[model samples]
Target: MPLFGRKKSEDPSALRWSREPLPPTPEPGPDGLRSMEDHRDYLLSCLTELPPFSQHLLDALDLSICEDVYSAIDMPRFDNSAMDGYAVRAVDVAAASAEHPVSLPVVGEVAAGQDALDRLSPGTAIKIMTGAPLPPAADAIVPYENTDRGASDVRVFAPSVVSQHVRYVGEDIRAGSQLFAAGAQLGPRDVGLLAAIGRDTVLVRPRPRVAVVSTGSELVEPGQELGHAHQIYDSNSTMLAAAAKAAGAQVYRVGLVSDDPESVLQVISDQLVRADLILSTGGVSQGDYDVVKAVLPQLGETDFTAVAMQPGKPQGFGLIGDDRVPMIMLPGNPVSAFVSFEAFVRPAIRKLMGVTPYTRPVVRCRATHDFGSAPGKRQLARGIVSLDADGGRLVELAGGHGSHLLGDLARANAIIVLGEDVTQVATGDDVDVWLLDEVS
Candidate 1:
């Protein structure tokens, strides 16, 4: 009803104007706080892209056999002697001992790596060296320590058993048996096994190529003189390269690029052509100088932005070029850069490198002090892990929680993960930790 009004029924249609639809809410990406489990699941689903490679034998790769495999060929290849003494019939030395010695004429001498020429007869013995082929007529080998050697005869003081010290053909390995199964990572002992079985070449998965770059004009090369005003030496490229290599990837450091759109686009284009994965640190935040955030959409569609994690909260992910090589953009701060790499980027690289079950080992520990984290985001706090009184592992926070503190990261052996919904934890509270180093 028009209270100030004049004509209520004259223009009823004019009063019934349609309301415009509100703009659609923006689709969710990696922004907003997320649970640890939710983040882990997202990462697992997204890291399905892996390089294709064939597996090979350990022997071919000069690796060891920590596991047992059935022999494919007869071991010992041939029947041979196992001692450097007299080879005689067991019947001849049945009663021979120190108290009652049996004497026999030596018919011939068989040295190692040589064939036995003469067969032993009754009342006769043949001198045999270790690894020499056993004479057909000899059934046992008596050690030299138990025999008295003479010009043509030897006296045995110890009784000899049948087939004693004789290595039979095929005793170690049988022909046509499976040696090793597929998918076993070759080791030194595996290498010996392959050699023993006569393998020359092995096929292995090709190493994944990872390209790393540092961003920001304020960052200079390590050897270069530092500028007095807000300039720092670049370390993210070197650190990321080393970490990639240690994770079995072939690393390529593209060095530092200024926080400029054209420069970043050119570097990313070049890297995407050669790298299976590209990692760049800096220029991901909302700062005026954040070039990566500005440039990524120009290069390719953004997969996500700003994961719900600390230190690395401003992370970004997307394809690099038309070829669609995966690229991950990390924050510039040293500790943030490293923590992001460990929590997400490392697993992705490992997957591309054909690493199975590509996830870090998580252990339970008791926090030494109370800890606090923002609600709805996962917090990875650096900590030192050690064995407690009951032999259980314990993790204590490493100094400061600031993202720029690289010193704390250096001394940290593990990362204490606080999940979303857990805002505060008391001392001795159970926490989940991922061990950074592989300790026995």
Candidate 2:
């Protein structure tokens, strides 16, 4: 019989001995707080190398090539005119000037896109348009203003220099050379360059697929009425999707899940099959209804929990399901979720997406207020950045530092990072800040 069914006399210590001691709680490292550096280092360690996949050339990819040199073939590809005037040999207008003008026969006209059949004779000129390839015999182009044109002849009042206003072959790009190098993100100019080189496709890194899930029964989708109590609008999914897209990932908004272990497990199980990375918000904390923390162990092992950061302290990371897709669990608070994503999730996504290291540009600036924090934890404060009197950058803290203050987050353009062991910082104190906006 089982110990619970057996009589106490049969096995007094059986019940007590059968019970297992609670697993020892993980001790927080260094002052009982995990610093930002610790969180970063831990995340970097968990990333596994992903297999390469073939993607279409036209796909919206963030290219990793930085330099590319393209060659030009028959640059201009033909002899054309360069000015909206006339093409002639320099010797033809050698002695022509305002005081002693020279007149010659303009036997034919050549516009850009049209070829000139009549070649220039020794003393003749041809009317040409801007961008028209220079004729083979022409060595200079005189502006229309410097010449007077008749029905079949033209008069020149200003002498032109050799090769003046003429676009030479292979001047812009030679026939053969290295086009774009590795690590360059193709943009409009790159597209034009590729087109110029007669290339319709290019090799690029495939975008990483990211699945976003927002957890919480209290979260109500927009356009739906929220119950009178304990209900909040679902913003994490949209926000995370947009952020992931901006970070060059193909975002699959997986919608919201209730705070139920079964539902959370189902969502992760479904997403793990398709996503390279799974990002979920809420349920990682040790709350009574925190289903994620419970389900994570059942589905996969937790990588780490409870990063030592304010507003985003309840965070977790782990693999999901048998597919082993990396998953990040962020807190339910809107600001907390956003901050956690930026601090931990974004870097991993960037790394997998082929973004260069040190992509987030940091700047040293002065704090405009006396911001204070606990000595043991790292704090990321939202602030507005501006240039100081001496042209140095300064960050001003936004009001309302609470984790749930979405309005403050909306107004913030920078994040002031206070490292561990630092308690208080007075105004004008030098600080390290990540600029959220372009500083002119």
Candidate 3:
């Protein structure tokens, strides 16, 4: 059975299905609801089709390589001195000691980038600065402290070995060697490496451009006077924008819209020209004023489904516009929207940017407090995961499990996941933990 375009019922109390009989308690199962992994795979299947270009030199610092970066020249292209010392023939100072000192005439002085035309022979030395090219016929270096520290003539009291204090050519990196592989995230050091290799810019995957929208008639911008008694602050757009930015995507935040389908559709249409992904929070539930549901399906192949998950069960996803940009619809509640982003949208953005292993780090830990979950529905409850004195991993609920509880979500470092069959979890029971703080 295809679960791709399953339409959810407008009323949960009187559930009805178009193709088959409704199950008890509106519990979506493996056959009815799309699994998290299946949905993620479907979203990632078309990401490779994103166009790549190397013509534009990346002006910003945060970028990732799309292919392996190879070196054009050998590192340390020439043999240079590693210390400020006298470049001399090792044989001249091989037998010199404190009691029987050897003297050598300093023929010339050389600093970094200076020509080393003077040749060093037996009983002669060149006063070489650090990073200076080695003079001809010089085999080793004698430090200034071991000699008289003189510029014209130097006396050596200690024996020196061949190739001492010398930096050989191609010692750090050889020409034609690969510096970094594909999918490697580039930082300042990586950029510097590319510069050292004589490349003005590198081929990198373009950052996924994300457009965030929040919908509701009973919402107003923060710091403004709330004239209506029912109006609350619109925070989902800003929060989702920040989250997308933190995941390495370029974010464009759309202004808040009312519960009108036409207005929401127009805003999404306007953003399709610039965005690679569109994320909207609010108005996708079983309510009459569900703006996202009413607008998204009219534009493209959007599917409004009831997933087997709590707080964010009413979800929607599809491709839209001529470019077929991916769009994710999250529930209206702030906590629910944030949780859905962490679980799905963030990873999708990373995947669009060619990042591998995009999912959050997961760990299994024993629950320190008792918690209850709805029957036959997966639950992702906020929790603070920590290690005890004995190195035992313990997980405790951050606060109440309500979808509107932002205080608990702020304090949570992890999302404790309970299975569909698990109705009640007692203390000491192990649960899978999705490490939210690791990525956010």
Top TM-score prediction, candidate number: 2
Residue lDDT tens for model 2, 306-354: 6677779887877544445578888888889988877888788777655
Q: What are the C-alpha RMSDs, in order, of all predicted structures? A: 13.8, 9.3, 7.2
Candidate 1 C-alpha error for residue 298, in Å: 2.7
Top lDDT model: 3
Error of 2 at 261 (Å): 1.0
Against the hidden true structure, what lDDT does model 2 obtain? 0.74
List lDDT for all candidates, in order.
0.74, 0.74, 0.78
Query: Any runs in candidate 1 off by more than 4 Å, and if so which?
Result: 1-31, 34-72, 79-173
- Please list the residue runs of candidate 3 whose C-alpha ends up more than 4 Å from where it truly belongs after superposition: 1-31, 46-49, 55-62, 94-104, 143-148, 155-160, 365-375, 387-394, 422-430, 438-440
> Model 2 Cα displacement at 322 (Å)?
3.4
> Pairing residues by index, what is the TM-score of model 2?
0.85
TM-score for each of the candidates: 0.76, 0.85, 0.83
Q: Write the per-residue lDDT of candidate 3 for residues 55-74, one digit (tens) a residue.
A: 33444245567778789899
Per-residue lDDT over 102-132 for candidate 1, one digit per residue giving the tens place of the 0 to 100 score:
9999888888788777667887898888988
